[model samples]
Target: MAVTDVTYTRHSAEAAAGLMDELCTVYADAYGQVAGEDTTVKADAFRDRATGALSARNYELVTARADGELVGFVFGYSLRQERDWFAGLDPAPEAGFTDERGGERTVVLAEIEVRKAWQGQGVGRSLHDTFLGGRLEERATLSANPDATATHALYEGWGWQRVGTKPGRPGAYYREYAVFVRRLPLLDRR
Candidate 1:
């Protein structure tokens, strides 16, 4: 389907709640097999966090709907002193990062998911492309389960490079998932 045919737009706080649930449902379904023991709990926490982020305006939630039905979405925000999208940890004291890039250098992209039924239909790619094109960042980063080969391939196929990996929690045998980064050209000035 044409990208324009799929309506992509920013969602308001009220609309975000329902969209967040759909996002979490898709997330749990995607990661449940890999996440043990606390799948629902963790997914619910993620949903709550997404909601909070939206409510605080820290993150922008963009949803894609085809024929008026939500099919895919992305959530992210401008990087601040205390908020880093991927790691969720404060940057190192000596990291030399700042959120004051005059609206130019935003580190974002916490999560992007497309419903299973919509996979391989260019929906995910459409969302990714739209997000990158819409943001002002020089680069975007994301962490993906290393064992999620398909996901990795998708990123790589889109010209994202694998930067590094981090260890997984105990009992999660799939340790050290890969981190991907993609440098994007500045959005059009016009």
Candidate 2:
């Protein structure tokens, strides 16, 4: 997957509703072998979460293609006050950190990845920039495994700031992921 051969596309989560199968394939192919994880199971879970996100208010997907083949994608949705994504935080974040009264307050960037052959050459960055460039949100947030240093490095180089870390609990072991935040540029309307 050469950088010059790539093209990007944006789709509303509704328009991308039927793409779970393909998206799962991309996810498995990107994370399966390296992580020594079961591809099918991971894909299944991803499909379920993605479906839920699709039904959410303002979910979006950004895909990257190389010669019209799916090479990578980034997907997430706007965070809302009604959602309890922040409730599980151990030490908790600043007061009103999860507040989303205006709906566009923050976007929870859920996932992003590129095929192995295409990584380290800017495909991920391109996909990320393309995904976030047009957002109207005030900021963006994401949670990532604390051990995934390389992934964190990529995000840090791109301007993400670590806000805090969450600890694992019995019912929500994955809460150990570190939370990161980055302010998004507001497009001038004046």
Candidate 3:
């Protein structure tokens, strides 16, 4: 099932909220295939996070569709000093590394998903690139389930570096995640 004619669209937080149901459906479809995860539980957590993200300043979302069906999406927002995305990072980076300094330094790659059938046909890459390409922030960061080998590989291949590990948010999932960072403007994404 190759999605040869997929279209990617960018949406602001408000616009994305209007299509929340469709976005969650695609998220659930993508989450359903992850090994060692409780699909229902994770999906619920994602919905909660997505809703909160909608209110974050500078929120941005990019969705990929093929044949009128949502197949994938990637979204995140500017990280402010108050956000504390790295609050629980084990063996935290040196001082000043995690500082957002009023949200001018880093943007987060909060979530990226591609339906199972569209997993490897460039849909994920397209959504990722489309979402991050326009970010004016100096860097970007994301966390992935360490066991998701293919996903980790994809991020590394796209110029992301494994920084450290962090435990999932207490109310989200009970697991450790590998943190990754990438410089912005994504110069190497070819």
Candidate 4:
């Protein structure tokens, strides 16, 4: 369905906390239980992760609402020089590629979720562009499930390049993801 009434809003971490319930609802709906994976449990994990990272430096949450209903959102944070976001990267990227100095080199795209009903109508791409377009970092990075072919294609189409692979978290057992990166100042692709 084409939604021409969508409105995009950028929220600070503090403001995002107030919309946690709404954000999680969209996330849960976007990723309904698959292979016995309960979305409630997954949503809780997402809540914990998102909550903890909300205070990270330069955190931003961009939300999309259609006719007053939340439909999608994207959130990310700048990477600190003292931390290595690609610590577990397999076949590490070329030397200096992953280096972060003064938290300006890279922005880690933590999550992007769109309601199932809003999947096609340009919501995901719009959210992605809006989020990255506002970043001041040199580049942005995100990891996609290796099995999500369509999602990967969407990112690639939006000018992201797969740099390498990163192993999933300890107990997830979902294998690895293709880490993608895109230079900053994204072109007006909308």
Highest lDDT model number: 4
lDDT score of model 3? 0.85
The TM-score-based order of candidates, best leading, equals: 4, 2, 3, 1
Candidate 3, 1-190: lDDT as tens digits: 5656998898999899998888889989886767876787877778888999998878999999888989999999988888777877877798888988778788899999888788878888888888888888889999888788888898999989988888876665547888899998645432
Question: How many collisions between residues are there in candidate 2?
Answer: 0
Whole-model lDDT values for every prediction: 0.68, 0.80, 0.85, 0.86
Error of 4 at 166 (Å): 1.4
Candidate 1 or 4, higher TM-score? 4
lDDT for each residue of candidate 1 in 35-120, tens digit (9 for 90 to 100): 34767667767776676677443456787888876778887766554443334222222253334355446556767877766777
TM-score of structure candidate 2: 0.89
- The lDDT, on a scale of 0 to 1, for candidate 1 is 0.68
Better of 2 and 3 by lDDT: 3
Best of the candidates, TM-score: 4
Task: Rank all candidate structures by their lDDT, best first, as comma-separated numbers.
Answer: 4, 3, 2, 1
Best of the two (3, 4) by TM-score:
4
Off by over 4 Å in 3: 1-4, 33-38, 186-190
Q: Please state the error at residue 58 of candidate 1 in Å.
A: 5.1
